[model samples]
Target: MIKIGTIELDGRAVLAPMAGVTDRAYREICAGFGASYVVSEMVSSKALQFNDKKTGFLMDLGEAERPAGIQLFGDDPAVMAQAAKKAMAYRPDAIDINMGCPVPKVAGNGSGSALMKTPSLCGEIVAAVKEAVPVPVTVKIRKGWDKTSVNAVEIAKICEAAGADAIAVHGRTRDQMYEPPADWEIIRQVKEAVTIPVMGNGDVYTVQDAVRLLNETGCDLVMIGRGALGNPWIFQQINAYLTDSCRILPSPGLYERMSVMVKHIQRLCAYKDERHGMREARKHVGWYLKGMRGAAEFRRRAGTLETMDDLALLVRDIVAANSVAEEAGR
Candidate 1:
């Protein structure tokens, strides 16, 4: 019974909110795979304050993805509070502040990881948002701005004092971006320092990785980012392992993979219209097709996907290409 405020999550794996990924359709898919919780893509506080329709749509939390949070990224405490208030229209189970984003456009603007430079400001933003929203308030943070300024413990303490319900720590510094190894030790330190639940995020691509992360960091949960791009089943597998006598599940078969990918893309098209959804789905298709037989040629075709019909044909071709290889291999 891991409860983030009033929201009770049955599983331990949470879907980390990615910018372009983790839309409504994808979140539903991840939830169906047993993700304990999911967070919407980061919505700019400033954008929400400006009454941005597109940004509002990004915060939509469907029933299929319950126990989900709407993540907001910004530097100003007052504006963040107002944005969180506005986000409540979407009825999110929680409100998460994005303090870990390292991209220049966000961090460069005194937002995201750049907020870490002023630890007090981070606390201020959390306090304001916590006050403005009725749901639980959580924050996602990194080790530090760089190796020289490691201060995750300090930030976690301040945020806790300012009323953060939980803390999610990404072990890499802003300078590290997504490269290099994540410093799990930093996550352990934060977990040790904070009384609230801590979610360890970074480099968890498999069930074993999730287990090792929880054991090594002593964190309450594991947040999957890139790991869940095309493989949401990791959540179900983790839940099974933890709750069912250490049982391990096999990877999805090729038929299941293609089937799920098609359903995911079809739902995406239905949600955002084919022209837009298919464009965004290109990367998703590439991820789903990864490591398959003739993946290179198939991915090249995936890149040019336009409509649901095109996706159907591509999936057929992919299945045909691999079905023969499987037959020959056996």
Candidate 2:
């Protein structure tokens, strides 16, 4: 078990927050699949401060997503604190501050990874938010602002001093974005420098990667972001792999994958309306069918889906096509 402040996770694998992807439906899916922890997408602190209804909607957590985290992003300390205070009404198990997003719009505004350039400001924000909320307060940060400014250790030290319960280190600089291989050495350094739990993220695509990260950095937990796309079963597989003497689990077959796609769409539709759900499911289905025998054509057709029936028909056609291909190979 991994403990972040008073929050005790049953496992070490966590679902990292992804905007537009880690919504209530998706968080519930990941949690049900054995993800010990899950976090909401990054919400705008300034927007929340202004009482933006949409921003408020972003913190909505499903009943099953409890022990889940809500992540907030912005540069202003006062705004972040106020947002944290407002977020408590939703009863998140913890509050995470986003300091690692590499998107230009977020970083350009001196938010996200921009906070890395100013350790003092980062500390002030953490301290303010910590005082405003009763739940555990954590921060997610990159390796640094850039190669020339590798200051995660310094910044993490400052956040710890400011009362952050935990720190998640994504092993990349803002300049690298998701390009270059993550420097796990930097994560190791941050872990060594801080007394609080360190969650390691970036480039963890498989259970082995998660295990290796824990062994390599001695981090308290592993956060999977891109790796969980279309693969919520990863959390279960990782848990089994870690505990069962490294037993290799077979990958899900076509039928199982398709069934999950349908379930995911249903959940989306239940959470949102049918129109918006189908629109969003298009991308998720594409992710689910990625690299399949006829995925390109299927995805092209999926983009035109306008209703649940359209999605069902698409899944049927894809399954039939896969069956024909399998028979031909046999």
Candidate 3:
């Protein structure tokens, strides 16, 4: 079990907070699949403080996604603190500070990974948020701004000193930005430098990678980001392997994948209007159908879907195509 302040997680794998992904529908799905914890996509502190309409929509969490954290991004300490207070009405299990977003729009504003360049500001923000929220306050950071300035250890120390309950270290410098070969050494160093729970992230796409991260860095948890895309089962598979000494199971069958895709879209439809939901489901459907037979053609067709009936037709066509391929192979 991993403890983030008073929040105790039953597993060791967490869902990383991706900006466009990790919404309420996705978080509830991951939680049902046995993720140790789930964090919401980054909500802008300034936006929340200003009572932005869409920002409030992002903060809504379902009951199933309990023990979740709402990640907030901004450089101003007062704005961040006020945002934390505003977020309390939603009753998140924790509030996570997003210090690792590499997007230029956020970083250019001295928030996100830009704060890594100023460790003092990082501490001040964490201290302020921690003071404002009654729940645990954690920080997610990158290795540093660039190769020449690797300060995760220093930043980790400062955050810990400033009363952060836990830290998540994404092992790539902001310069790397989702490139191949994350430097796990930085995560190890951060874990060593801080007494609070540390979560190791970046390049954890497979079960072996997740296990290697935990064993190598001694981090309290491993946060799955891109790996979990269209593969919520990764949480269940990793948990079984880590907690029970079970063999890593093969990927789900095509029929099961289709079922999940249908259910995922259905949930999105319920959360929003059917028209908008199907549009939002385009990328997720693409992710789910990736690497399967005739996926390219199916993906091309799936993009044109505009309503529930269109999506239903697409699923039927996919299944019929899969059946034909199976028989031909046999």
TM-score top scorer: 1
At residue 82, what lDDT does model 3 achieve?
94
The whole-model lDDT of each prediction reads: 0.94, 0.91, 0.91
Model 1 superposed RMSD (Cα): 0.7
Native RMSD of candidate 3 (Å):
1.0
Candidate 1 lDDT: 0.94
Q: At residue 42, what lDDT does model 3 achieve?
A: 97
Clashes of 3: 0
In model 3, what are the clashing residue pairs, if there are any? none
For model 1, the run of ten residues with the poorest summed lDDT = 1-10
Regions of model 2 farther than 4 Å from truth: none
TM-score of each: 0.99, 0.98, 0.98
What would the TM-score be for candidate 3 when compared with the true structure?
A: 0.98
Backbone collisions counted per model: 0, 0, 0
Model 3 weakest 10-residue run by lDDT: 242-251
Per-model C-alpha RMSD: 0.7, 1.0, 1.0
Q: Candidate 3 on 270-302: residue-level lDDT in tens?
A: 987788888888888888898888999989988
In candidate 2, where is summed lDDT lowest over 10 consecutive residues? 49-58
Segments of candidate 1 deviating more than 4 angstroms: none
